[model samples]
Target: MKRRGPFANRRLARFCHEEAGSILVLWIASLVAILGMTALVFDIGRVQIAHGDLQRFADDVALAAAAELDGRSDSITRATNAASKLISNPQAYGGDGTLSGATDYTLTFLDGLPAADTTDPSGYTTTDPIDATLVQVVTTPVTLDPMFLRATRTLAGVTGPAQATVFAESIAGFSMEACDITPLMFCKPTGWSATQASSIGDGILLRSGGQGAAWGPGDFGFLDVSSSAIGSSCFGLNGAKLIGCLIGAEDNVTGCYAQRGVTIEPGQKVGLENAVFNTRFDQFRGVMSQFKSNANYTVAPNIISGLVPQGNACGWNNVSASTNSIGLPHDNCFATGGCTRFGTGSWDYANYVDSNYGNRNGILEAGEDSHLVSHIPAAFAGTRYGVYLAEIAYAQTAGLPSGAILSDRDETGIAQCSSNVSTNPARRVVIAAAIDCTKHPINGAATNVPVDEFVELFMTEPVGTGVGSPPSFDLWVEVIGSAGVAGLGAAGTGGVFRDVIQLYR
Candidate 1:
């Protein structure tokens, strides 16, 4: 309005010059807001990442425990140790906080579980196919303490120092069953036909054994029997009483004579000297009794080791002897010629028996003509008569252990025959095996690398009668990855990956 000159203009401009555009205050305020937001995001993200990591680690530990529930002696201990080792340093897996609180987890067989039973008149309803109990695998709660987030003292009053709990659970079926022993190969000295016998005695001789009865024939130091014979004989004496019989003329010695099958007097022990005792019986009545017993027999590719050496020995060589063997044969009717078949190819082999050691031989030869056929097949059965052995091998590439545990909580060393079932026909023996993901590598890689690691094995008994008959059994095996857990769970944390396997022999 005054229309001043250049000097006037300069004075006015200076006076009008305001600090509005300096923006120092606005910039500082903006910086404070942005920094605060960033800090919130960083701390929250850190806590979240830690929680996620803890969960993942917990899962892995649980899975390890679950895998150990196969009813092994130290399986639970091993799995617990493995779980702790897996997360010993959770930070490696991106966990920002340390888990504190309870240590030690457990893998155990569940008790009082309802037996798998079904009542469908249709006779086609699927019963609880699983014969054993459920295995419960529990993982201890993993607790994590906040580290990065704790700095916000304000949160101490709000939510308090962040704490988290992680858990995992899994179920496993009965890993083991009672020991059952069935004859893989058997022959009454009279049960064998000339065609079934070679110069090597009766082939019907089979073998079996367990914890207390580890004695085998070859191991028989004083007996000096064959190992193969002891292998089978080990099964016979395992739980039975051992009393040596005097080898005198049948009728010549009555007082010192060993009654046919009387219970032995306590504290009295005897041995048959100068004579090797086989299952053979000379009496026609004895021969008839042996033939009428129900004794199923079959054979596998290899012999399983029991408490005693497979060879025949009774505290003789190695402590125990095998009752079944190709060398030392058990015969009820050994005539001058050899094993005599009842009818042409009428001899049959089965695992179930109706009598104990005393009377088992009575029907050994007359199985076809006696009550052996009337005996109903038991619901549970196994390949071997009284004992069942299942061996699982993990290649060095698989991450799993090379050994497996039997149902009886036995670690069954890396060798074969570590797992055993009863030969009784009333029981069944089933084997399910998988290669360790850590030990058995796929694609020839040095390590199996993580995938759906799994392997399925099939066990079967041949369909034929008599010990000398060729074994004609079939088994199927499947190998897969994560799918293996279908029988088990594979949650990667609480999941148990078990390959479902069935045994019907």
Candidate 2:
């Protein structure tokens, strides 16, 4: 070194020594900082993983709670137990990593829905929605602290704490339909004895004030008569007086017929009035007297098809009035209408059979249609149009074990009522639900009562008696979610829900 001033040399020496020690101190400080930052990252990542696990556990607990609810009892306790088994820390407190001042979780019940009365006016009932019956179990929310950084106030600004919470919800009940049976079985055709034929009306007498023609025993013949187009004309009948005759071979004159025979329409219920037909005009005079009969008769025509009968006293030749009895057991036929006395062709006879009788009611009269077992009576009448069944017994079995009473309107605009079917697999009450309110009906296999249990229950009970009456129904449990039993598709999905529940008694 060259000769230098004392102040300059001393300053240079101090700079070298002091600055060298300062660099080592800085390096050591930076290493410590790096280690602390690395430790913080580890703690944060571990806590994040734990939080995710707890969240999944909460979800599992919710599903468990719903399943327990399906048992039909003890819902809240079951939910709590299920939650404890799922979450890691059963008693984990909610808050900023502190047990104090935390929001406690709890399991609770949801109230059920009200019942419904669908009887009397109509024959169906319904249940409430599923969302209204849902219950829930929730866990207490808590705040967790970061392990490394939280220990020091200086690192507080680096990371923040987070809160965790979990929640779960579930649903659970059966559905039912029934009918009513009552008095008045019309003409017991199926059960009647052969000797019962004597019970038909005696000598036919036209009840006064009634329209149409009536006939008593008489004989007459026609020949060489004056033909009239629209009015009665004179004709030689047994060489005596003649009236209302048309002599033309092919002429069809209204109120004037002395030519040939008439052809009755097919599928028509006809009434005979001591009258016979001649196929040819040449035979008209020779067989005129053969058209007569010895018995006095009052004939009435009724149309029976399917399960209904259509007729009015106005169309019958000798009906005193449009009587309601014709639609009842004695007057109506089950398979066909009326008797074919003089001629025999393609005749479809009436066949009346039910679980009650198991056979035909009798031969259907020409003026009558469909003669099945007379579960209803002719003299029977009701204030309203409906079917009523009473005094039915209920059993626990799946099969419908009872019958109901019914009252229905007749063609004469009267209410005809009837009842009395046995209780067994053979003769159970045919409880039916009408799709439309206006028309009386029963459940059909396709568009109506498709379910076996539903049909059995309905047939066992009375579906309110009367033409337009509905049955009584009770709506009980409505299930939802994976745990619920009332929905159509697989449970657990979001769409799983019970839209309707119907019960019958």
Candidate 3:
């Protein structure tokens, strides 16, 4: 090399001192940090989206399963099928895509849940299908291969698990609201279940208690149709308004009642016309005479009460002792006054058949429908309600002859008061809330009294004047079954149950 010049030495020294490219080195290092931050945000967003998808799936499955919990024997089976087979949804972002089969989620049936939503779900679960009312669903955990996080980790020369797992859970329950039900509630007998198999077809004698008297088992009272549960139409209802609600043709005029509880109408409400109850049997008398023509108060298609009209007037005199009169008799225990509110299902079936159809063997001479006969037990011929249905079928097949006249009465199943006859056989059946009187003491004007269950009662006879010195308003009915039971064949007939499903979490 030649001897270094002064200019070259100065240029070299100036070049070493200059800071021109220093910023470029810092910028390259900052790029790595910026990229890592962007990756973190993107991965977090994907995980959040996946969590949202899982939550939705869990909610839908819970609702579907809860809808099928109707307190039936097959409730859990139906709920499981509804949950696994009825719903299919797609999950995007980080899930396994489609959620279809049982493997995609887990189900837990619960009988009770803590009132609060924040409570954990481990303790309140149930295995019994009939008692299960709430349902819980949890999505299967899904492993996610994070798009940005994995690349960020690789670039950093980091090894180990880089995937994320996501899942969600939800709870739901089923409830019912009875609509268009009769404004009536009876004291539930000791140890009565909603679906009491033995109690079906048993005669129940419902008597209205004295004003201000504490109601006990077998006593019944009117419901406050004016309650908010019944809506505004029946609000502020008084004496005449109460009668109108009782006689209204539209079922919803009385409004909807919750299964939880009901408000008791304040008074004993004495002197309600017998005609009001008789209208269901097509016997319109007193105040009910004018409503016969109106379709709303249409009489039942079969109105075969044992009592003959008194001299063509629309009134029934005492025909209970008459041999020719053949109405469905009260239980043998009732005539003797040996039983309490409930009567042994043993009524004189042979006498009923002989007095009405001239058949002593309890078999119709004309061809009888086997379906109707199937419901009648061999030991008792038929239950009062079962016989009532069979009589309808009998009248349909064999033209009503003078011999088949009900209880030596000119009145037959055909309505003479009006041509607009009620075709619904369930017209004679009314839904009544059964309450435990001991647990909930009701005198009058009670609020939010808990109901044990709703029951379907077949009117065995029209409301009648009682025989005691003070006299009572007595109604005789046969228990059909608990409302909405599949075995009863009367589910949804009386607008007794309206099911509602909702998510809890």
| Top of the candidates by TM-score | 3
Q: In candidate 2, residue 473 scores what lDDT?
A: 20
Query: What is the full ranking by lDDT, best candidate first?
Result: 3, 1, 2
Candidate models: Cα lDDT each? 0.27, 0.25, 0.71
Judging by lDDT, tell me the better candidate of 1 and 2: 1
Per-model TM against the reference: 0.27, 0.28, 0.68
For lDDT, the strongest prediction is 3
Q: Looking at model 3, report the run of 10 residues with the lowest lDDT sum.
A: 316-325
Query: What is candidate 3's CA lDDT for residue 213?
Result: 81
Q: Candidate 3, residues 1-505: lDDT per residue as tens digits?
A: 7899999999999989989979989999999889888989888888998898889889999999998877667889999999989888888876467877799899999977887778887788888875688899988998888878999888889999799999999999876676677778888766776476677778888987655788888888777666434434444655644654464443435666655458876324644555667777666666567766766676665666665555543444433333354578888998898898888778887666656656445655553243346544453345788787666665565545632324334456556555666667777888888888888887766877766677889888777755443345688898887885322222556765666688877
Cα lDDT tens digits for candidate 1, 130-173: 21223343445555544544544453455655554555444433
Candidate 2 local lDDT, 117-213, one digit each (tens): 3223112211222212233334454355555655543444644553233332222212211111100000111221111223221111111111122
Please identify which of the two predictions, 1 or 3, would achieve the higher TM-score against the true structure: 3
lDDT of 1 at 383: 17
Regions more than 4 Å wrong, model 1: 1-25, 71-78, 81-87, 90-505
Error of 2 at 321 (Å): 21
